[model samples]
Target: MTRREFILAGLGLLGAAAAGGVYSYVHRPKFGELPSGDRLKRMQASPHYHGDHFENLVPVPVMSEDEGGHENRFVATWKFLFGDKKGLVPAHPLPTEKTNLLALPREQDAVVWLGHSSFFVQLGGCRILIDPVFSSYASPLWFINRAFAGSNVYTAEDFPEIDVLAMSHDHWDHLDYPTVMALKSRVHHVVCPLGVGAYFEQWGFAKDSIHEEDWDTEIKLSATLSVHILPSQHFSGRFLKQNPTLWCGMAFITPKRSLYYTGDGGYGAHFKVIG
Candidate 1:
């Protein structure tokens, strides 16, 4: 083919691939279902829920001044996809430690980091798993955004009976459909921000198994275990739309100690307010 024809053909192929990706995303069942009817009404009545979407207590731009604005997200994303990533990853597989999660004593308080925002914590007789994502990739595409080597060491089988499965948000990385499906039978309770439970509901989890809360609300799981849902300067959504559900941090407070998990968010006055 001529040089001009070669370039045109490449562009045409790229356009075709993009269109196919869009089509797949629109039809994918694992993308999750949205809230409606009574669930939608409940979300609408929430103080943080605006008529069209959820809002953070303090306003923070989705893109910063340094990022250059809304359009710059695409630029940054392009750079991330194509830029030189020499030191972006470890040269060797990262080392890991194996722990028998099921065998651990209930009296022994501990915390285990399971890559990214996922963690398992045992405090005050509660076995809490936060933002558990065991799937190979963070995105809906099975092959894209694969987990780093050696970072994905734990799966649902590694976990004991999760007394409380705390979800930070509805982002694909935090809430993996396959992982959640695998864990649903093992987990006792699913706790998350208001409207996020709709995803769990759609996944076929019992309504009694899911608990949704607004920011600053508290759920006392047990006599010694209480979860405080606090303000976080973040927005949430899994699809093209944004902030259909609320996003916030979680503070696990026990009679003897307290631990806080900061979900995804931007720096703002809410940080000081949280402090």
Candidate 2:
């Protein structure tokens, strides 16, 4: 073939590949739906939502130069692709142990580490599940952020009826698509900050079941159990639009015990505020 013809064919192939990728990204359920109508209005009501994006309580030192979300994302992606990652992943399967969640006594409080950022806390006679990412990989694409072997032993089906599905943020790692979808029936209610409940609503959860709140607010889950949605130094977005939804840390306070989850945020004064 002529060099001109070969170059033309290569360009055509690249165009087709790009188009295919765009289509997959648009139609896939894994990408999730953005907030609209009442959800958007509710989000706008929050003091955090400024203009088109959400903001931290104060100018976060970690994100002072974050006026451009797209640029920060580009830098992050560049690092993920070509940056040094020598010991980021384990070379061998991680040692893991499984617990029969159903057999655990609900009356006796306990905490279970499902993997990564996921946790199960039985407190104040309530079965509380937090950040339950049962999927092997946290990213939208399966090839990236693969879990260590033997670490992903638990699935959404393994859990018993959950009283509270507490989500700290809407990041893919914390708010897993498949795991939450499967547990929706088992989850009695969901507690998320600000705009994060839009995902649950779009995924067919009843509006009444989703309790969306702003930071610095405390939710009385029961007479003896309460949860505090507090500020954190972090940005949120599943796709490109950063901080469209709020990111937060949580404080679960019971009569006899109190626990906190940082939810992927960097250290900030919010820690003292949580106290």
Candidate 3:
């Protein structure tokens, strides 16, 4: 074929592929539609549903000040190239009771980073965990590669009976299989973005215990505790197929305090909007 004709044919194929992908996503079975089997029923909403804009994977705008000058230009370019490699090595050692202070009973509000994006938060006599990753590395294939250094100060065995478990997304690192299964019997509620609860239900968590939410939705945990799903600049994937699931950050607001958990996100205007 002539060069121009070849280019036209390639463009047509690209358009066809894009149209097929959109059609599949729009018609895919939602979590509620899936068979319950032995699993519990699905929840109506999650405290951490941010929004559906994640369907369009647009990079958040970077500010000029944050971008810096030509000298720093390379930094931005390098990050764009290798940013996903950040989690290749563990950021810090697995937190211990001394390091995370999770063992202490707190009368006031407190928050501790478990590792990666997992956090142990205590507020108003209630304990909540966000994206609790306890495994050495955030990977499905654990034997070949593992997390760098840190060990969980508290394992699934050590976790107190939690009032709320807020999962930001369904990435293996954030939503561990073994960890969630262990917490299933003890956790009062599992709040997650839409479709994530399906994973828990499949894992045997009670249907009444799993609550899923769409973007910008809110859930009242108690009279004094509320969780709001906020927008995040990020993508999600557990297996090779990308964007099969949803992702978001969370804002936990209590009568006495407010905290934001950016589960795993690229820095974006959403931070400034939250501030």
Report every candidate's CA lDDT. Answer: 0.86, 0.85, 0.68
lDDT assessment of candidate 3: 0.68
- Model 1 root-mean-square deviation: 4.6
Ranking by TM-score: 2, 1, 3
Q: Per-residue lDDT for 205-226 in model 1, tens only?
A: 9999888998889998778988
* CA shift of 11, model 1, Å: 17
Per-residue lDDT of model 2, residues 19-53, tens digit only: 99898886677677788888889888887899988
Q: After aligning candidate 2 to the native by TM-score, how far in Å is the CA of 107 from where it should be?
A: 0.5
- TM-score per prediction, in order, is 0.86, 0.87, 0.66
Badly placed stretches (over 4 Å) of model 1 are: 1-25, 65-70
Per-candidate clash tally: 0, 0, 11
lDDT of 3 at 232: 73
Candidate 3 residue-wise lDDT at 9: 100
- What RMSD does model 2 have? 3.7
Evaluate model 2: give its lDDT: 0.85
Superior candidate under lDDT, 2 versus 3: 2
